[model samples]
Target: MNESYKIISSSILYWFSQKKWFVYSILIALFLLSLSTPVGLTLPAYHSLIILVLVFILVTFEPIPFPAIALLTLVLQVVLGVAPPNEVASSFMNDAVLFVMGSLMFAIAIVHQGLDIRLARMIIYFFGKSKRLFLMGLMTISAILSSFLGEHTVIAIMLPIGLSVIKNIDTQKTDGKNAVLLTLFSVAYGTIIGSIGTPSGGARNVIMINYLQEFSNVNIDYWKWMKHAYPILIIQLLVAYFVLQFTFPSSLKNIQIKGFKKKVQASDTKKNINHLFSCLIIVFIIFSWFTFNDKYGLGIIALAGALSFMIFGMISWEEINKNTNWGVILLFAATISLGFQINETGASSWLVLKFNDLLEALPSNSFNISWSIMAIISGLTANFFTSSATVSLIGPMAIELQPTDITFALSSAIASGFSFLTVISSPTAMILYSTGLVSTKLFFRVGILMFSISIIILYLMSQFYWINI
Candidate 1:
């Protein structure tokens, strides 16, 4: 009897490990039952839970972009009585969604013209041109680009360069494993960290901020976001650098290859003109932001920039049609729509009740320690849900915990941005994983280290930079 029980348990564990769907389906069924039962969940909350489950299923099993999934989910919610039929019509269209679409499309245009290459080479020229220095240089450039362009665009721009450099290093029979892995990670992580700096950096940042404003009236504006978030981002970058240094092979030395000059020069020419113009437009946008916050939202300015680029033929109509991430947009919309319902219905509140119970068990006044713990917890939870979705789901609860402590609320949001260790964590990871530059274990190891070190940095920075315990 004992042997049979052990064998059965082991078999179930093995089955779950190989087929994740079995586990997810079981949990989803449970969530549904809790909702359908007299458990007192609101209709909107139930709808959001169902959509949330479906979103994960799509990401891991079916794989569709957010926008498409969002559109379909909204339709089905209305049709099937998940959400109110009248209210469902306008759920997907919002300033935030348009802002994301505009930023993504504009970034695609700018990167397509080789703008990233122009600056990447310039950084190499000025920052000194050794192999490791070039890697760091490219990483710095990626972070800067991602702050405005979106991390997905940062990867799109740097990925080709990263591949070329690694292939060149390997052409001479040198082991390229560490170099390849480092380059891919540096680019991916740079964008991931950089995205924390602004509303436009990653949609998650925007999502978190929007939810905050909706729940609590303490508006975090564009410049306000950078005021504190940039400090955290800089700390995270340092952490990523040292962690990468340790992970890199000891035998690997910086091999200065002047051979990449042709690539660099062409890249500069292709990107420089567009880059200069784009930079100017970005400057204009920033100025307009400070000068015109009440008159025009950032979304309008971003849309204006995208439209201007299109009119000037910097991006052809065909390119717009081809390069747009329609699926990501759809998925984001569905998640947002459903997330709104969840937040409204107080489902997230009950979920936080469970999290708060865990926190209360820690101590009487370990507020700082508790919030830091929550930061890491929020980030890990994002692995199962998206950063944006997780943030929206849990951020309100985090803020409400120590209502006097704004630091806890905001820091928790920033920490959730560091989902670098798994291809399953964020859209950026999914994008990089599909590139096939490194193995899953390599990506996982690199990501785990990066994330761990980043949490430490955030913890320390919170001590010095943020408010009291």
Candidate 2:
């Protein structure tokens, strides 16, 4: 009996050691739950805030799987009386969630068709003259494609092209390694910067749009979104090019290629009529997004595109199921639901009041200064958390910051796309890191510079450019 008790105790201790983050989150939640509600906030609102804290801890550490975290969010909402079961159910699934699901599926379809190979050929055709031009072209093309598609989709497609280029080089030398790192970083950061250019560019953009319409009644369409965000995208791309060049200098001036062109051409010949059909389908989807997104939400249009790909036999359902990350979709849905509850329970308004109180303490908390502060917070938060999750949580407070001015909301949404600070901040960064060429130390070093410049560019655009548009 003594030996059995010791074994049981050891097992329990081992389990606790493995799951300390989870235990810490629960204890924090309980401690907060035991406190009296804040003077101005309702019980439900206060409980929602506690859930928010719990979620931040869980997501930051990821003590459990993402789908489990998503399910816990829904369960906590009902259990804590933040909302009724029916309301929770309604909020769990929405157009934003659908868009995320469809976009992931869409990326699989595009890559499955092997269009990325053809895209690589075009990049080499246009900018194969000089090493600097090739790097610039990669960044420019990635930014352009990602503005319409998405960072995940563009990076998935562009990574292979960059790798193909790097494969032809000698990585044992310092210049060759720098060239490789520069190419990969260009693809990653360009895709990230361009993801803010349109409503369809990233799921976080769609989430912000949904929140804007649902909470603030501000109806911004695809073109309007592009008008506000595209200039900043262009500016960031240019700045990133120089920053990347400075960080990873390569003195080898000429493109040294023997048979890559011939190899790409040989693969191009294998493309049949199905590839043409795929191109047509993508063009139609982009047209629909630009022309009819106001009539049909971006989610429905994205779903329609995915369905088209399946109907035409361009991609199989199994392919999508195998490639898509469903946990992210569910987590986006859950966090979005929490965001809605935060607003409905008046928690966001209370937060805005408290924030305003803090802002007032500063000597020069002008409108521009306030906007910059919120954008900086959103960008910083996005660096630690997924951009979609950051928006799902921080977006409501932004809308509440200035109920009358939409600039505050737009800045927050756009700034959240600046996720260049960490490897896990965006999928593009993760994909780049997976190549094993870019070290974590080097990634963070360049990211600090890119993130800082991007924030400054965003501030300038908001002050000078967005107002005119």
Task: Identify the candidate with maximal TM-score.
Answer: 2
**Taking the tens digit of each residue's C-alpha lDDT, what string does model 1 give over 257-280?**
355555677644545577777777
Stretches of model 2 off by over 4 angstroms after superposition: 1-11, 253-258, 268-270
Measure candidate 2: CA RMSD.
Answer: 1.7
lDDT of 2: 0.87
Best by lDDT: 2
Task: Report the lDDT tens digits of candidate 2 across residue range 1-469.
Answer: 6999999999999988878899999999999999999999999999999999999988888888999999999999999999999999999999999999988888788888888767877888898776678778889999988988899889988888777767867878888778878888888888998899999899999999999999989999999999999998988998898888888788753235334567677654337576788788889999999998988888888888889999987778988998899989999999999999999999999998998898899997778777888999999898888788999999999999887677888888898899888887889988888888887788889888888888888888878887787
Q: What is the TM-score of each candidate against the true structure?
A: 0.83, 0.96
Off by over 4 Å in 1: 1-47, 63-68, 76-83, 171-175, 250-256, 266-275, 289-294, 361-370, 399-405
What TM-score number comes out for model 1?
A: 0.83
